[model samples]
Target chain A: MRAIVIQAPHDIRVREVPDPTIQQPTDVVLRVLRSCVCGSDLWAYRGESARRPGQRIGHEFLGIVEEAGHEVNGFAPGDLVVVPFRWSDGTCAYCAEGLTTSCPQGGFWGSVGSDGGQGEAVRVPFADGTLVKLPSAAATDDRLLTALLALSDVLGTGHHAAVGAGVRPGSTVAVVGDGAVGLCGVMAAKRLGAGRIIALGRHSARTDIARTFGATDVVAERGDAALAAVRELTRGEGAHCVIEAVGTEQSMRTAIGVVRDGGAIGYVGVPHGSGTGLDLDAMFDRNITLRGGVAPVRAYIPELLPDVLDGTIDPSPVFDLTVGLDGVADGYKAMDERTALKVLIKP
Target chain B: MRAIVIQAPHDIRVREVPDPTIQQPTDVVLRVLRSCVCGSDLWAYRGESARRPGQRIGHEFLGIVEEAGHEVNGFAPGDLVVVPFRWSDGTCAYCAEGLTTSCPQGGFWGSVGSDGGQGEAVRVPFADGTLVKLPSAAATDDRLLTALLALSDVLGTGHHAAVGAGVRPGSTVAVVGDGAVGLCGVMAAKRLGAGRIIALGRHSARTDIARTFGATDVVAERGDAALAAVRELTRGEGAHCVIEAVGTEQSMRTAIGVVRDGGAIGYVGVPHGSGTGLDLDAMFDRNITLRGGVAPVRAYIPELLPDVLDGTIDPSPVFDLTVGLDGVADGYKAMDERTALKVLIKP
Candidate 1:
């Protein structure tokens, strides 16, 4: 089987790897149909996040179940399913509370000993708990399949940010970052009925997509200017909710600055860099709320899937580039060079 | 008129000061009936929080309206009232949003050029917004008055913490301080229908008050031991809601340690010292939320007043010492030396 591997910083390769097999009673083998490069992947590619040579690299995919163990009751061969970034046991206390990311028995894809999603086939543990079955027809519909693939990570993460920000029918939301997840956040806020959405991004192409995703306003400025622009648009009060999709310290600062006093910030970007923590004194004085982390996409998928299936939200637009399994390195390079919003791969 | 003044660290004096009068069209002058020494005050007393010599010091009090300005529509002379720690214009956007503490026109009592609650009279700005009218009968009921006084700060603060923590029916709550505010948090959690409440404190006396207020369990451990005890009590998942009323770095760390995955920490303690900010890495991985600050007591007064009036909760137990106008100095000393949980004053 061909799989993407991180050989070194700025070096991605598609190489022959041993095929995955069901190793446990609850395991199943998946033949991946779709996977993509994520904004988070850029961190390791940039040598910012440490990664060992030849480590598996992707964590988002939708696929057909190629094989199932005896205990895997919810899924069987030939069934299409979407996999969340992390796998959970579904019955743990955290999982029951809708925090599957914290499930004690769960682990992320692409970890040291695990199979990455950007591969021909991978072994999935806790089959019933880790995979969401997709409609049979989605296996052949490219557009719908792309949208369903988003359910595996970005769309659900965006929903998590919106939920964390307390987006409601009349909320004013400001999303910081123009990446795929941030664009998805705009869609999530709109789906949740946000009255106004302000997207902060400098790129015209990304901001154009943001407008299509339901951003009522776009602030192209950075730093103080961006803060000023958001405050001006919000009548000097700032937005009621802020979605922080970029984990950089500057992005977090912008989020803190643009959120109104007493408003909340929902931050889902994987934290990287130094001094990324909140300014406690400022947060305290303003009575602001900071919530969000690695999103529990598994918990959110059930709710967001219906909208996607019904065509109410088409998150497929986030994928601006596509590649074949052999071109996985090009997908990583395109995303790294900002030439693609998100790169989808067909295995 | 006489008022408590901060002469220096460890030095408090009740000295004759100019009597307060309605200074603006929105101001009301109140003749103090009851005021209390707060744990926050001990900061200035111990020279931790900077205070100028001769600065007025208290910010919790109930009184009779001695005079009202032409624009003070809701309050008049001879009316009994309870004052929030800060005065906010009732019509401000923040106040309308129920975040009165963030009102642009709001100001704290005891600030420079303002009369403190420990004085015989106070000139309250935004009379219609800052003061909640008390039943005329409360003036004579010492017990009810004490409970009402708690609404001026501690009780409302506790309610803020509970609300911030997302306390719901059947929640398991942990309160991380034994001060008046933390005890009130226990009561708040109970009032909100929390099924289990854990109070963390070392003092038997305060924990007893916490039990009376509604703490179903008490953990006297500190640091890792405290974290271990709370995790054990909650079946290794920690509490669903944690109220952090101690502003020290250690207390904040304990709060972070004792909250369950995807749980929230409501912190109302006035932040002091270095390294009091959140550990963002840990929070991000666990999906924890941090909220709460200087409470919007003015907005909460109306909701909590009815409970106090009907004796549903009595926060008076926190006031273990009483002092008269001339004995304000001793009140400060007793609170500073930890001889009293809270000290009530009559002026």
Candidate 2:
């Protein structure tokens, strides 16, 4: 099997590797159908995070079940499934709490076991918990397929940001990013019944896509202008909910400053270089509610999956580029430089 | 008329000042029956806050109407009243949102006015909004004096913490700090039907008072030990609500760290100095709901005043010392060094 391996900072190469096999009672082997490079993956690819030689990469994918361990009863050969980024035992206290990403017995899909979704074939752990079955009719539906594949990551994350930020019906929400995740957040806010959605994006193309995703308004401005515009749109009350999808301090402050007196700020941007630190006394005085982390994707996939299959929500418009596995390097470079909102990879 | 004035730090003098006359149509003059030194007032005396020159001190008071201006129509001469610590116009959007403390025209007594309640006479601005008319019997009952006086600030603040922190029937609450405000929080939590109230205090006397106010367990521990004790009591799930009454970084962190996931932190402490600037990313990951601000005392006074009159909840224990207007210096000294929980002054 051929796989992409990151040897060290700024060094990634495709090489032949041994195929993965089911190792645990809950394990199932997946022959990769489609995969994509994630924003987090770039952290290591760009030398922002350390990566060892020959390590398997990627946590997003949709695929066919190549084989199932004897104990894995629900899944069988040739079954279509979308695998979330994290694998967890569904019965653990944390998993039961809807925080499957932080389950004690769970681990990141790409880091712990045989392989990651970015490769030819990867072994999924706790298959019953990590894999969401796609209906046969929508299995080959490219638009639905892409959206379902995204449910493994960005789409679920966008929904988490909206819900955690307390976006509600009639709420005015300000989304603070232009990436695929931010685009999906506009959809999530719409699904949650937010009356008005403001998407802040610098790029014209991304701004247009945000509009298509249900953003009622788009602020091409950044920093104080963006904050001012949101406040103005809200009749100086600021937004009822603000979503931060960029991990910079400026973005965090923008999220905080643009929320109304008792509003919520939901942030999911993995801190790039520095982290998010807030003024305790100020937050205390402002009465703001902040909530968001790695998405509890598995918990929402059951409900979100049907919507994706039936075309109630199409989250894949954010994926502006698609290519064969051989062009994975170009996909990474395009995303790293902001040339593409997202890159979809096919086997 | 006699008034309590802080000539400087550590020097509070009761002296004759010009009798207060309404400067605005919304103002009303009151013949003060009683007033109490506040924990916050000690901040100026101890030089903890920026102090004004010859500042008129004292905020809590129960008094009688002496005169009313043209615009003040709610009461006539001789009606008893409980004046909130802050005066609000009542007609602003902020007030309509139930945030009277943050009302655009609202301001706390003693911080600016020269005739705050620790005097023979005082003037209340926006009297119609800040002054509530009770059945004269409930307002003048010496039996309900302390609790009614408490409704002006500390007791209402405690209720603010309980409601903001989301304590409910069968919920567990942890109160950090055992000052008068914190003790009142214990009482408020109990009234809100919290199943367990853990009061963290170092002083045995303070802890005893906390238990009397309905603390099921008194963790004489500060910092880490208090958090451990709270977690232990909640079967390792942590408290459902944490009321942070100490306005320091350590207390704020403890408040955020000790609550169970999805629990809330209601903080009311006016920030003493600089703080650790809360970690937004860490808090986002923890899934905690943080809500707090200055107490909207006027909003709670009506509900609490009746309880005080009926002798259902007693907050008078907070007024541990009594002083005549001439003894204002001693009141400051006693409260500053923790010699007294609160000092009441009879003009």
Model 2 CAPRI quality: acceptable
iRMS (Å) per candidate? 1.7, 3.1
Off by over 4 Å in 2: A15-17, A70-74, A112-115, A271-277, B113-115, B273-277
Report chain A TM-scores, every model: 0.99, 0.96
Give one digit per residue, the lDDT tens place, for model 1 in B134-251: 9999999988988899989999999999999989999999999999999999999999999999999999999999999999999999999999999999899899899999898888
lDDT of 2 by residue, B189-305 (tens): 999999999988888878898999999998877677777887888888788798988777777777876787666788787776424635555555555666777788898887887
Model 1: iRMSD?
1.7
Give the per-residue lDDT of model 2 (tens digit) for A152-268: 889998999998788889988999888888888999999889999999888999989889889999888877888788888888888889887877778877888788877777877
Q: How much does candidate 2 score in TM-score? A: 0.92
State how far residue A284 of model 2 sits from its true place (Å): 3.2
In model 2, pairs of residues that clash are none
Error of model 2, residue A134, in angstroms: 2.2
DockQ of candidate model 2:
0.42
